[model samples]
Target: MQSAGNGSEDEAQHYREGQEPPNPIAGITGDVPGTAVQAGAIYGGVHFHSHANDEGAVCQLPLAPAGFTDREGELGRLAQVHAEVGDTRQVRLVVLTGPGGVGKTALATRFLREAMAEFPDGQLYADLAGFAPEEAVEPDETLDAFLRALGVAPGEIPRGLAARSALFRQRTKGRRIAVLLDNALSAAQVRALLPGEGAHLVVVTSRLRLTGLVAHRPRFLDIGPLDAAAAVRLLNGLVAGHRATIGAGTFRDLARLGGNLPLALCAIAGRLVMRPDRSAERMVAELDDERRRLAVLSRHEERPVRAVFDVSYLSLPEEAARLYRLLGLHPGPDFDVRAAAALAGIDYLDAEEHLEYLVAASLLGERGDGRFAFHDLLRIHARERARDDEPAREREAALERLFDYYLRTAVAADLTLNPGRWHLNPMFEDARESPAVFEGRTSALDWLATELPTLRALVLLARDSGRNQAAWQLCEALWMLFSLRKHYGAWTATHQAGLAAAEDLDDPAAQARMLVALAGAHMNLGEVDTATELYRRAHELWVRAGHRLGQAAALENLGVADIVNQDPRSAIARFTAALRIFEEQGEARGVAIMDRRLGEAHRDAGEYDAAIGYLTRAVDYLTTTGDDYMASRALVGLAACYLQAGPLEVADTTLGQALRVSQRAGARMEVARVHQMLGELAQLRGHPRSSREHLQRALSSYTELGAPEAETVRQHLADLESDTGEEHPGEELS
Candidate 1:
């Protein structure tokens, strides 16, 4: 049988006021008429009573606050745990741990008192006094108190701590007693107190994790600071008549000022109710300063807030203090051990130990998933400490390291995001090249998408650091991901930063690239004027650099924008210019792309023969360059032109060629477009069933691709379904 430390609630000064004259403990008789009894049991006093009256009569173990509202979820969890008893499924040990003044004791007491029926033998409660400034009660003393509760003779109690605990456990071995051990010193202190065997359920509450005791197969419940809603509910309930007098705003302000801590909220509510006339608003205004927390709390004649925090903080070791300060420097919402270790310049194992210390001190939180975070108020408190304690240069160094790490990682992610985009100079040159990582194009792209926000933050950080080259390079690396994902807002912002950085560096090539990225966003948004302006500026920059490839890219983009704006003539002129630049540069890829655009402009202008000629040239260039995907698109354009010119045989042959190339290239969008064309051809030939099938396939492909043409394909499919009296196979067009 396991033994417990000899700590008793009777020794704690934080207990309710006044020592009561010895009263009968069993079957509480009518409030003793002005006897002014204490809230919980008074140890070693003349309060003992026998259950000889009948079958185990009701015995009040502790006075838990009634209607302990708003922690309904926690209460339910307690009930669920209590229900786990009696099935030999292992006696459940739940640890409710948190910082001082977070109401761990109160919550445990309430849960145990309400669940007393489930543990009929009796309920044992003790305060380990782990955080008390004075001497803590010994395990032997606490075991003696438990023996006295079990009707053990004073002289008969064993002198040995282990023997006394074993006898105490043996007494309640068969009978289930719910033990609530509060203010636990450490895991070792707690291990001695746990009862042997799986018959008794023990719930230990402490500020520290007590992970050592966790190995005994106890489920841990890490209690954090209460949220605003629960804190306010707890506070309002403590006031006289339990009428919730605090206004919503005042309650919110009080909850926040109390740091959403249950004990603090309780104290504030008690003070407010006692005063009656003083407004919570004025109280909140007074408690704004961290330095004045104690003073402000003392104004209500309740315990000081700073004192409570100090009791928790002063219990920690030196390592925990340093880690707390380092944690205060983190700007992210949560952190992991690796980052914490990096900040402390320590090994991961040492950092984890220090982290547990801070968690014990209530300065840090270990979430259910094992990630760490600080309470918002504690975060603020730590940051304040960091500002006062840590050197500015040191902090800046840490931040820079963090920023650089993210920048390097994000740049690595970019290589996979777009395997096809050929950037002139490598981005993030200072980042160590690790070609062994990223594995494949898909892996890189997935990483980039997942880390996009962090990458964006790093870009901004680089810009803020006056690292203009890094800023521009960061933007460039992310170009393909941003473009393909259609994150136009981020695309625009990053490119704007890149544009300024490029101009600062006086790099015309970088300037052209930035404008091209910006213009892509504008083009996607259908802002032709903005797109044209950016494209023209990019073209000018490229021309100044005499970069034919850059000039061709800009011209092609400009032509596409013009075509989207319905300025077909201007688009044709721009496409022809781009084609000339590409041909001169021997860039077959660029030439093919420009030829396709030129054909589209000519077709839109009703010049079918000219469109066919340009498309044929585009297809030939794409084919020679082995760019079957682009070749397929050019062939589709060729087929459309021939179909418009009434050459059905030529159209059929061109369509077949496009279909084969598109299928081979695995270009789903192009494949869908080919199906759409065939569907239209089938409709013209009066083959309703075939037309419906092709159109439906095209719509399905577009939907899968999330392509803009999905809606149009669905519309065509609906029309074919309607013509064939086939129940409109597609959903309503609108």
Candidate 2:
């Protein structure tokens, strides 16, 4: 310590005397310690030294992928992780895992390039070739490269793996660097290259799970295949210079055929680019065949989607591979373990284990809530595997079991949601094996909402495959979802398919049911005239089939159409006749629903007293029955009556109650309607700010639902703004 002080004091004296001090290290030259050093120096001796700090920050990040599209979500997640790991002692490690050709490396590179400012110490990149045909790069090689990038002299670098790792940590201490270890083979490979200390960020992209990085507290992000829109964009970018013209629909078809994988889409785009004279429509027709689709997507043999998928598929354990192949036969968009078990003819525990294994291997993805789904391309590859490897009988049996599972599960959900509703499908009586259980109407509706897409697809599949009964029944089972959730597109499409299936079967009652469902969809879509025609046809069919309940249901739907058409007198007559039929049939719920309809009609007719009486009775009955959704509608009607009459306070209280009931029941339409009424009431009370707030909330809800009422709420907000002379008003009053 004394000798160190004496040397430093002597150097200080030499500096004060206006003379340079001797270099402390031999064969070294620099201005002074704690001062900037000049760039570019050469040293030659047994012992050589250079100013390590003279090197500029290493900017080793590769150019971001060309035509990078729709990774804002992943980039945002990276930003969030960076924000959360602020200034921590431990280095932040983010592992991006997904199947090959899923664009994990592109996402990582894009994020790091955009985030360069965060790492002043600079960027480093290494490609380990984890899933390539060649052997993966070793960790020691990556470490060596990283050490050199960090400005370590060649002679000073350690030879042993442990020493290199320790030196890397020592070199990176207190430096904020960003290291991208691309195509990593394992957690160990990634670990060896990670910065040993400092608030650094290390992002690793790998096709494998790399679960061994758990001790490092790595955040794992799973990159999935591009969506259809992004896939089309990628194709468009790749083929921008080509003379070939493709229609939007043809592009979408190509994207679907390619399973929206970026690699496959690029190949498709390459085909279009190379053959500029070829028609995309013809290309789509050729790619539509599953057997040839993979071949078409293999235009780029270097990174063919099929070959990439084969590598992942071949690496899977035997049981997981078998389950993955059978999952290709699953008719639904996604599946749970129970459905997988049904497809594979295995038990739940085994299915879960296999599915987990596939998920880890990136052959499958967990779709939340204990469900798993394959990437579309992986699904196609799995289908090809099943077609080639599995016997025809086995494939057919797997599909049949999956279809049965979906059918029985849909029926169970239907009966649970609509207890005692008339169902003509014989599948209701068929024994269900391991059907999904719903605790109540809410749970049933939730399940229906989540599975709506799958259900719609299966309905079409069944209809096309000559499973007529299954088709119509699946449509009928979806009635509750369509009625409540108001997915008008799915409702209309599935019912049209169901109607065709019904006609094919020549069943009058089934036809009536499908017509009613289709009419409801049209009614919600503002096609009142079309809805009315459908309802009348349904009523005629119900009469022909001698089904009075169906007849009453049709009458009620027609009354709803009448209300929408603003013909209160016609609505009243329709509701009155339907009410009588419901009463005669002892359908209490039907009667309450009719009462609500009558109340709505009376409110529009300027008969506040009659509306109040009808709506109050309906609300009391529906509330007692735990039908909060219907009760909220009736309450809104009652509130409108009170608002039209003289009791503003009662109207406000009623709307508040309706809002709570609608929210609790998840009746989004009713919730929006209540907000609309509240906005009108606030307007009437000269509370412009309050009116604007309520109307804006209503507008947001309606806009999200794609409901026409959004326009009404927007008009309300506009009028309030005009009346108050406030272009943008202040916060709401108490």
**Best lDDT goes to which candidate?**
2
Could you tally the backbone clashes for each prediction? 7, 0
Per-residue lDDT tens digits of candidate 2, residues 30-75?
Answer: 3322211111231332232323646789988889988888877888
Model 2 misplaced stretches (Cα beyond 4 Å) = 1-97, 102-206, 213-266, 269-285, 288-291, 299-304, 331-333, 367-371, 412-422, 425-436, 440-442, 565-570, 601-608, 724-734
lDDT computed for candidate 1: 0.69
Give the alpha carbon lDDT tens digit for every residue of 465-498 in model 1: 6878877877888865764455656777878888
Please give the CA lDDT of all the candidate structures. Answer: 0.69, 0.79
All candidates' TM-scores? 0.67, 0.71
lDDT of 2: 0.79
